[model samples]
Target: MSDKITSIVGARPRGHGEAVARILSLAAAPTFAIMALIAAAAPADMLCAAMQGPLSLQGMVPMYALMSAFHLAPWLRLVR
Candidate 1:
């Protein structure tokens, strides 16, 4: 005697969250380093302009925070 079986598929595998976390965490350091280098190499006037420009300090903090969050959130998950 033989038995028949069927398989069903739905959403594709999104991959392990830990994998995403690891990649993001590893990427964060390099990304920050590059950004820091760029900032350091920029002319004083450019840095001042960026600080005083339309975004202003107030806008800059949130933007940076959001970017940092995107970068760190995965790593935080991995740590947990």
Candidate 2:
């Protein structure tokens, strides 16, 4: 296909940087999930004892789980 047609259809060829970014993007979901799992399973007191104020696994676990859920769309699209 011609460049103009491919561009119009959102199929433009990817560059090296774009490829690298896509790879990193795909890895984001799993990374977030693993972080969330670790936070949820580990002893919260031990993990956040030194942390004061709002700095705690209570906040971080949900954030990481939410991030993992949000990043799952790309993988779902790939699967579909």
Top candidate by lDDT: 2
**Segments in model 2 whose C-alpha atoms lie over 4 Å from true places:** 1-13, 46-58
For model 2, residues 1-80, the per-residue Cα lDDT tens digits are 35554443343536655555555677899999999899777875754655635544356788998899999876776577
Question: How many clashes show up per model?
Answer: 0, 0
For model 1, the stretches where C-alpha displacement exceeds 4 angstroms are 1-15, 46-80
Global CA lDDT computed for model 1 = 0.50
Q: Estimate each model's TM-score.
A: 0.38, 0.64
- Computed on alpha carbons, the lDDT of every model, listed in order, comes to 0.50, 0.70
Task: State which candidate has the highest TM-score.
Answer: 2
The lDDT, on a scale of 0 to 1, for candidate 2 is 0.70
